[model samples]
Target: MAKGKEARVMIILECTTCIRKSENQKSPGISRYISQKNRHNTPSRLELKKFCPYCYKHTIHVEIKK
Candidate 1:
């Protein structure tokens, strides 16, 4: 049987730049990416550089807990 917490967890990655820009500028919303990671394999939060259409550039996307 698969334990609830043992399965790969789904996380959301939001663009850091987009978040900052939203504070100063009027924008639609934050850019977020959905991904999965194994809890056992990656004990720490995952971060990736991804393209943000709203920001029109690449920015650091940090993992956010639900």
Candidate 2:
């Protein structure tokens, strides 16, 4: 038996708000999250509501190139 390409792929999610205001950020780094998704299920960029410690609030985390 042979297996083809993996359907589940690892993706990096970064806070949309943080990236825009990197210069104004008090923290040293921008908040990011690690997660997986099914390629066939979500062909478009994945976005989820996640908590950003730096921003101290829930923000839209969008998929970014690993």
Best by lDDT: 2
The lDDT values for all models are: 0.88, 0.91
| Local accuracy of candidate 2 as per-residue lDDT tens digits, 1-66 | 776988899999999999888866555578999999999899999999999998899999999997
Give the alpha carbon lDDT tens digit for every residue of 3-65 in model 1. 656658789999988888788988878999999988899989899999988878888999987
Top candidate, metric TM-score: 2
Worst 10 residues of 2 by lDDT: 20-29
Which regions in candidate 1 have their CA more than 4 angstroms from the true location?
Answer: 1-4
lDDT of 1: 0.88
Considering only N, C-alpha and C atoms within 3 Å, which residue pairs clash in candidate 2?
none
Cα lDDT of candidate 2 equals: 0.91
Per-model clash counts, in order, read 0, 0
* Cα TM-score of candidate 2: 0.88
